[model samples]
Target: MKEITIYLFLLFAGVITAQTGSGEYSIKNVDENTENSDFGASFYGEKMIVFASPKKGVSLVNEVWEENGQRFLELYSANITDNGELYNVRSLKGDVNTKYHEADATFSKDGKTVYFTRNNYYNKKLAKDKNQWNNLAMFKATVNENGEWVNIIPMPFNNVSYSVGHPALSPDGRTLYFISDMPGSLGKTDIYKVSIEEGGYGEPVNLGDKINSPSKEFSPYIDGDVIYFSSDRPGGFGKLDVYASKTDGSVFEPVLLNQPINSNADDFTFIINPNTRTGFFSSNRSGGKGDDDIYSFIEIKPVEFKCAQMITGIVRDKNTNMVINDANIILKDVEGNPIENLTVNNDGTFELHVLCETPYTIVGEKSGYNPQSKTFTTSNEAGKITKLTVLLGTGEIVENEIKPEGLPKELPEEIVKVRPSTYVVNIEPIYFELNSSYLTKEAKRELDKVVDLMNRYPNMIIESGSHTDSRGIEGYNLWLSDRRAKSTVNYIVNKGIDPTRITGKGYGESQLVNQCSDGVKCTEAEHAKNRRTEFVIIKM
Candidate 1:
């Protein structure tokens, strides 16, 4: 009994979010017929695609070759309308179709040269392997002056003992990629490429460990630097799954395309038109019209990074309802570490980036107005911006106190007494690295001033608030901000201040002083303005 190889794949399963361009794909059967297995589609001319099918037709039906108990595959063409609908299905004309199997074809850019896979047959004789099974081979044919595919010649690498099929050409037509179980293969069936030159072909080079596993890997389709193929290696959703790998020269890293592109059955032959982002792939999964059927897909518009979550808002007076220009605003994460500090614009508006799914606090203050703070949280949705309005009560300006020098002209020193003894000190923004809460040397230097203040006023109690830019996952940013806030408090405690006198909280990207919310593009400097650390007076 011939042992049938069952190719299965183990894959990482997770909920596909909108950001990875996952949910936008809509798949449907492409003019499928119930009787035969139809698959392996490649672009043919302007409005048609060529594929292989084993269904009975008018041309000729010879002896049946029972490999999978199906008739020999033959090349067929179908017209695709402007609306991406498939129609006018028929067998390819000329002498291309023969008694032996013929399928898996690729065309040159000019559509003159066609390379395809077929059973090894020369002069009405079948080439067989040691097991009495016919081995597959590749052939090339060019359009002759008579408008027919003539002079069919076998590829130089074809052999009677082993199979070499599934031809794919590089964009420049200088390289041919194919699958073979011939000598020097790392897997049962591996994808290999040979350099195509003017004379013939160069050495067949294995794609190496990056693309091939101990299992089967075939059906390679190249579009620019990205190569889409089918593999049965571990970590897939089914027996076979479609995968994509990007190549920088000779290096490749395969990434599995999760469902609905892949299913729990054999899925292969993925080809796409890069310009339209529309393509076709074949699968034998249930619900198809036949054993194997072609499915079409179109990419949804506006692919976005799911991590880009932000918050933006403005500050206004309590009664006047007017935008507060140049008002000092501080943002903090849930753990109470300062994330950013900014002053409202001349129009009483400010924008700050914040992380998603995190709680934050926005504090707005002026020298004479009553200091105000509001706490809110962000959501997990990408490209979502949270808006806010801060109302501060009017108050009288007090006598002079020592102010930090070289502060931005827009941000003046604010001294608001919380009690007869304690006063709020509005400090400069404290910055951290992207996606990091670890304190930098600059951060240490800035915190040193807070240490000095705590030491000078031994009875003072302070709250450290941390904030982050809206460039990462909200929950993660909140956690990072919490760490940052605690790090700040720890620094002060290490400076001989009692730990009980200081507390830290992280306020994620719930408050923005400007329009730098999710889906809004901002510069690094602008995002830097949102990541800040602040110290607020609690008691004295």
Candidate 2:
């Protein structure tokens, strides 16, 4: 009784015939009598190729079905003419046939190579354990001279101990898409891709849950940014129908291929030829010769948008202007869109990728220097490299000005007298880290004050001093204080201050205003007050 039921089920499965019209298509001269012959895929404006079995062709028929049996499948290809007519139909040579079950072949856009799946069609006895009998492998072939394919190599990353098949190439040929039964798949079979990198194929990335369900989804083809694959999930025209997906950046969302395109049988392995509305695919449905056969369809082309643009620039000092290597450069879009920011190379050059036609604010910062900022807009018309040059200025100093604050009121009138030589001037604060020589924010603020004073007095020479608190050993404090004072002078020099009129000195612990000295316990704040850094205007 079970045998009889299986025979009836096999008998009900049918085939497809030649179809026409803008969106209508069919498989021609398909020998449906052979059950294994099915699922053909091709791109528009390219040769139509498929996997099907012939009764007496080069396709070897080793294993035969017993339910009113004698069904075999092999891979075949047909040259599609410009007018959408099929011609020069022939079976693909080498690695394509194994006297076993082999069919379902897809070609790259240039038609230089092919990726297809082949199961244990050669394994004769269907062991009691069906799981052990379902192992399949995916293979590839590159076209050689004389227009024949050679160099058949098995795909590396997508292969597994179980099965791997149904390969697709992206429009730009930068990605390889295929189906596999590897672990972590959402279904019995799932779609996956491996990026084409500089050295070789990159690691595989799964199509994720959106496209592959607990059911089966396979046969992936890429047109522009859209991915057209096949799936047997629910809500289709039939058993296993074709589905499409749109990819934005790195994300892909599935879109069902509805209506007359998908039917109540198994419709899959579809390819869309670029620039044309026509495409070639495969299906196993009723209304024709036998079990499974090839089919074709037509679809509208989709619009594509640009993703990003490249920007490059250099950072240099304004005074003794030299390129500052390894300086950090940040670019942010108006909405604060951030990408992988970069730093200046050893040669002081940096590059960044930003969205086109977007407003971006940039900030360049480095140690021991003031932060620089600028705003810029990027557009598609601009080339990959948009050059942005930046020059950092140093702190400034002023000369010949009266001391505004911190003056002694007890000084005699004669001592305080200007004598026509009192140069009123302000010194910019050279920033320093807490208890360290590293520059700080407060330091830069002091320098700005110095810059203002310089604009007021242009001819006075200025002297800067470095001092340290008495919390530590006098020797160490001396070196730290000296570095702090010199750093202050360097800041002013970089800020356009005249080097000839300025001097720096480190007092170490030699000078002290308060009684707090080494070994004298005091609060950090009090110690900090003792660690204070001060700058004085000598000749001004």
How accurate locally, in lDDT, is each candidate?
Answer: 0.72, 0.59
Q: After superposition, how far is residue 468 of candidate 2 from its true place, in Å?
A: 65
Question: What's model 1's overall lDDT?
Answer: 0.72
Alpha-carbon shift of residue 3 in model 1 (angstroms): 13
- The lowest-lDDT stretch of 10 consecutive residues in candidate 1 is 3-12
Compared with the true structure, the alpha-carbon lDDT of candidate 2 equals 0.59
Summarize candidate 1's per-residue lDDT along 412-516 as a digit string, tens digits: 244344322224555556888888887888888878877876676667677787888887877567677888888888887888888888988776674444467
Give a tens-digit lDDT track for model 2, residues 1-540: 112111121222233332221123433433323344444545422555554554344423344544435544466666776555566667776555655446556666677777676653323432122334345666777877776667766666533255666677777677888777788888777788888776778888887875788777766778655677776666566666667655433222355565456777776667666556566666666774555555555554232223355556778886767888977877766776654567779999776666655688877778877877777665432122356676665522111223434344454221233222232233432434456887677877776666556555565466566777775666567678878877877887888888876777666665544556677777766656555455444544
Best by lDDT: 1
Maximum-TM-score candidate: 1
Poorly placed runs, candidate 2 (over 4 Å): 1-36, 43-45, 58-68, 120-134, 158-160, 249-253, 300-540
